[model samples]
Target: MYKRAQYQIITERLKESRHFLQVVLGPRQVGKTTVIKQVVNDLMF
Candidate 1:
């Protein structure tokens, strides 16, 4: 499995608390959006 560090951390947090509000903060072009999108997609399936 090829997972980014941020992706893994966010995935674990989401699994721990599905209802919690998740905020991804960072400067431009840092893969913040990408991580959340990937996580959301994974959770859907």
Candidate 2:
């Protein structure tokens, strides 16, 4: 499986901190959006 580091981090944060809002900040094309998309997809299933 292709594991994205950011994806893992986001998922972990979401699981660990349900009350806090998670934010991803970086330059363009740095996979911030992609990570969120992947996280959302995983959560759906």
Candidate 3:
């Protein structure tokens, strides 16, 4: 599967030792949920 650039960035941030708030901002109808779900699911297992 082809992942978006945002996916890599989000994944990297989440893998860090230090925690920080990551707010995803964008217009409506975008794949915000898709990216988030992909990231969470990938990290879950």
Give the candidate number with the greatest TM-score.
Answer: 3
Arranged by lDDT with the best first, the candidates are: 3, 1, 2
Q: Write the residue-wise lDDT of candidate 2 on 1-45 in tens digits.
A: 455788877887888845688878999987787778889999889
How does residue 8 of candidate 3 score in lDDT?
94
TM-score of each: 0.78, 0.80, 0.88
Which pairs clash inside model 3? Answer: none
Error of 1 at 43 (Å): 0.6
Which regions in candidate 3 have their CA more than 4 angstroms from the true location? Answer: none
Superposed model 1: Cα runs more than 4 Å off: none
- The per-residue C-alpha lDDT of model 3 at residue 45 equals 94
Quote the lDDT for 18 in model 3: 98
Where is the poorest 10-residue window by lDDT in model 1?
13-22
- Name the lDDT value of residue 8 in candidate 2: 79
Candidate 3 lDDT by residue in tens digits, 1-45:
768789999999989999998888899988888899899999999
What is the clash tally of candidate 1? Answer: 0
By lDDT, the best candidate is 3
